[model samples]
Target chain A: MENRFEKQEEEKQDWGAYVKPPQTSRPSQESEASAQSSGEQLQRFEPRSETSSALCDIVREHLHALVENDGAIRPEQAAAMFAHLTICRDCAREFDELNRIVSVLNSMPLSPLPHDYSGLIMLRIEREMGGLYPLMDIPPNLATSSWTGEAAQQTSQSATQLNNRSLAGILSQTALPLWSRVVMLGAFFATLLLFLTSAWGRATLDATLSTVQDWLHQIAQATAEIPLLGAITAEAFNALSQSVHLLEETYLHIGANAMRGVFLDTAIAMGVYFIYQGRQKAKRAG
Target chain B: MRTVTLVEQSDAELVRHTLCGDKSAYNTLVLRYQRQVYNLAYRMLGNAEDSGDLVQDTFIRAYGALASFRQDASFLTWLYKIASNLCIDQLRSRKTRSALSLDSEREEGREPANENRCNAPEDMAVRGAVQEVVHHAIQNLPERYRQVVVMRHLQDMSVEEIATALDLPTGTVKTHLFRAREMLRGRLRPALEMEADGK
Candidate 1:
């Protein structure tokens, strides 16, 4: 036995070379009292099988109920069972021991990790997948753009407008939920159509457009003095300006009929969003 | 728009992102549950090397099968299912190879591993002896009993969760748990006595 223990102690020492040290705790001290009292409040859960009963074990019949941890036993039965344990010293000793084991197991501190496995696991995953997956989709940035690439100079005003919309679309999708986007965009176009139907609506559109244009210019100019940001902000402002110009021209070309289509599309989107809302609510309720 | 940090995303959201080919989202998931998985494997397999290997395999297997994961069900329990199956396979394979440890192959009527070592409470009251004894005692339990006890008691998995993970009925899981504790009672009785001695 001493040799066996010596071997185990050696093994534990070797294990400590990689694994963190085990915590110092006495299992007996953990949950001694609450086991019996909690047992009294629990509902009785008699096991269907007594197959585990050894020959000569008299309290084998009550063993399952006597040490029941789950609330399968009723309080009255538990109390009576506890009382019965007192009558049988052997059963009482078993109950006390079982309770100690439960408490100790319950309070057993989780074994600590030896080290962060993230870097190694991630390294293996990256090799397995053949590339590093970026933390999130890389946001559009002029800073990271290839200045030497032909695409930078070749990007036309229309291409920039498309790129601007693409960026906006990505950000909108990421930052806002579908319902919020639907509500905001649908309401904006619907309200715009409402305004366009009257004489003030065109002015309102112009005002909103100009306000947006001015805000872009202000941001562009304010950041222009900051050296590195000046180019990106100027490019962004130009894209927005072109987008606003395209919007006004499109409105003029399509006339009031296009506004009607906008209203119709907004109505459909709103309907779809509401139906989505209802389904989500039902799912959560279920 | 600010990018949502990996920490801010829910498990479901992470799963969705992973399915969408976001590798980092899966990493977030691995980092979140690796400790739990490693500990589960350690308790089940009884070694650090195998448990560490199992943790990596669990995550990799989970990622490979993420497409089939039912969004409505639990992510952690699903991982448990994978981990438990792997553990059983490893144990069975070990048994097949005749490499199963003597402690693991313990018969019900056999002498306790430390019976002679712990003849008296005073002899058993070494520092960390209770945990060490309990650990060995758990290692002695039959595989099925060990799985249920580790998942239900150690991992804090609900009965329903254990049933789902092990593909057993809740009633059967409860039976296994009770029998496990019953087995533990005899082996661990010494530790409790040592504790009662306040060592």
Candidate 2:
């Protein structure tokens, strides 16, 4: 009994009547007209089958549904009663032909959607989600029906139009070429050696330093000029004090530790000068 | 002009707004193309979670690289390229890992049952069996062929659209679709023969 039931189940699995509507290849008006005419032709003429009356009745119903639906016969309907349809050659032929027509009809596509699909799409647009394009103001005149490549291209082109240069460019300039940096170091040492070894160069250096100090002392009038001159003067004084501190520790016979406070004093002055310059620049720019 | 405007703005305008930091405009694109991106990822990866993440990642990466986007390529096409490359990378990584991954395991488990059940009854068990078979068969297809076939049939994309999106020639898209279909037809022949024999 179990084997028999299994066999019956297997028999029911037959796809003799199961037909998927041919995915409509085209939905041309002419093709639709022809499908209607072909359907009418089938309606006017009933296929004759030398088979059981019940089987014939099934075929007629299936055929009528196929015509009315323009070939949208279901696979479930076809598979349900394959036994009768397979034996009747005429019905099978008619079914196969109709199935082909339905495939084309199925390809016709769904109905025209409402105009608001675009609006619905607009509502769903995210501010942060454009894959390659950030959002901005688009002119009201350019809105349209479908998203075309031309439009995407235009938007992508526009998104990159702003100038927001980053600080990385300035930082990258700090990386000097090896040869030039080495040359600069060599020139600085050469000038220092010349100043110390040559009595005339040393006198000239002392004279120039005194003149610079006098000029620095005179520049107390304008607060605006303080940052510009003060930054340079502070940097010069810090370097001079650092060298003097080293000299005092090496040869001055003074308590070297006493100059610790001098280094700190120079550093603080440089820091204050830089901070003041930064604030002034910020205010001016603002 | 009136009809087009009544419907929506041009894609170019939308892209322009997107570039100008109009956050909503970019969202429009995301919502418009997320399904396509998701579908491609799903077909390629055969895992919903991975596909979803891949789509999101693709969008994120695309956003970062938006400044370099060329105007000549279709936006969706550019996006597909990003999504496809990501899927391919995921697939390649899966291949190198030596362990049999979840996607593979699902394929291995489902393919045989699907083969057995396509001609089976319409009951729940049979329906599940057929669905598994469909998924398994599609999942097992070569990555390129699998993408083309899904993009064509499931997504209802035209060969031209698929070609444009993938940056392949139309001929290539058609060929891939044809070969993919042939492969499916062969895989499915057993069920057809079974149905034929039962009759």
Candidate 3:
């Protein structure tokens, strides 16, 4: 990870590149020499001249102190800086630029508040306050009620028991292999079929089937007696049938789309795997 | 039915009322400082949504710890301290989690369309560009310098107030502010010059 200072240093280097050309064009040999120097000594031991690059550095350091102190530097230092700026064109220009930048920053407008700023904050505070003291708003009468006390306790106990029972049921269901469950269901159905094939069981099944058919026939006859009702019922049944057909079509379309996606994914995965393997092989050969 | 105007209450008066079980007094306090706190957070975090959440969290934390608040300290400075700490924590966590991408920073820097209410489109565009450049420069400052810069320039805080909030010496805050501004001046010079040339 890059340290924040390292990033700032990189930015400084970039800025130096941008600002160097103007300084280099100056006719001062000492400016170029100071600019070329490296390490910590560059800042401390660089030779100063009226048009030298180090002049800008000196002016900048003083400018920062002056600006931060709101021009309240000692009179002697301020006079010296002003005198230098009057004599040095480069330092004066740099000073004006730095001052302009500071003014611009200080004068940068504050963003306008959102229209409902206070309302939103109050809402949030209220919500947080409610969370902090949940029962603060509850009336004293309701706070001491039996329903909120003993009844709540009973409800909680019942909920716990229900949760435990449901957990046990889930565990039991998962304890058996899926195939075993299927086999058990199939065997039960087979035993029921065998019992129905016997005389008494067959008789009971036939009677129930006949009763369902007779009820359907009666409903159809009553509907037929009212032609309007019969037509509406027929239309409703047709709509229901169409809905079922549409649902089946949708299911098929989704399944086909899912299969296509899976195939595409597998192909991409295989291509990546081959590429990776080829790279590994080439590495070994090299 | 005795009534008093909430806006008339001083911070100390409001704190007194809040401690005495009047929630409205606290609400009044939130209303008073919400914008400053939000603007500070927004400038620090550079995301409006995150800043909003920080503001809400700061107030909630302040409410919870109101009992320990010292009477001698300025309320705004105390609130700023909480917000600054939260923002620093966020920045540290973010640095640890992943490097911030320039693309995401650009995206976050885009203001909401509705928020731009300036009448002159050209001037607004120029101002926006300059603001973006300046914001990027500030974001690039090291963490300590960045905090002082945001507090002083963006938040319009006094040096003493900032020193108090950050628990730093007055001279140290001044030094950081100076360095931060110098770095910003270097970074913003080219872009601002271009804008000037274009004009």
- Name the candidate that leads on TM-score: 1
Chain B TM, cand. 1: 0.88
Could you tell me which 10 consecutive residues in candidate 3 chain B have the lowest summed lDDT?
B111-120
- Candidate 2: segments with Cα more than 4 A from true spot: A1-286, B1-7, B99-125, B128-132, B190-199
Residue ranges of candidate 3 with Cα displaced over 4 Å: A1-59, A115-286, B1-3, B99-128
Worst 10 residues of 2 chain A by lDDT: A132-141
**What's model 1's lDDT at A109?**
69
- Number of the top-ranking candidate, with lDDT as the measure: 1
Error of 2 at B97 (Å): 1.7
**Backbone clashes (count) for model 1:** 9
Writing each residue's lDDT as its tens digit, candidate 2 over B1-199 gives 2112201544445555555455555566776777777777776787777876776777777766665677555788788879888998999798779464544543343343343333332332234343344455567677777778676666666677788777799768866665555555555444433333333
How well does candidate 3 match the true structure in TM-score terms? 0.51
Q: Compared with the true structure, what per-residue lDDT tens digits does model 3 show for residues B1-199?
A: 3333667656765664464444676788988888889888877887788888888888888877775678568999999999999998988787667654432343344333432233333343366577766765666666688889888877889998999999999889988887777666666777666565555
Candidate 2: chain B TM-score equals: 0.73
DockQ of each candidate's interface versus the true one? Answer: 0.19, 0.09, 0.12
Docking class of predicted structure 2: incorrect
Q: What TM-score does model 2 achieve against the real structure?
A: 0.40
Top-DockQ structure, candidate number: 1
For model 2 the local lDDT of residue B164 reads 78
TM per candidate comes to 0.54, 0.40, 0.51
* Chain A only, candidate 3, TM-score: 0.27
- lDDT per residue (tens digit) for residues A47-76 in model 1: 223421231153455556445545554443
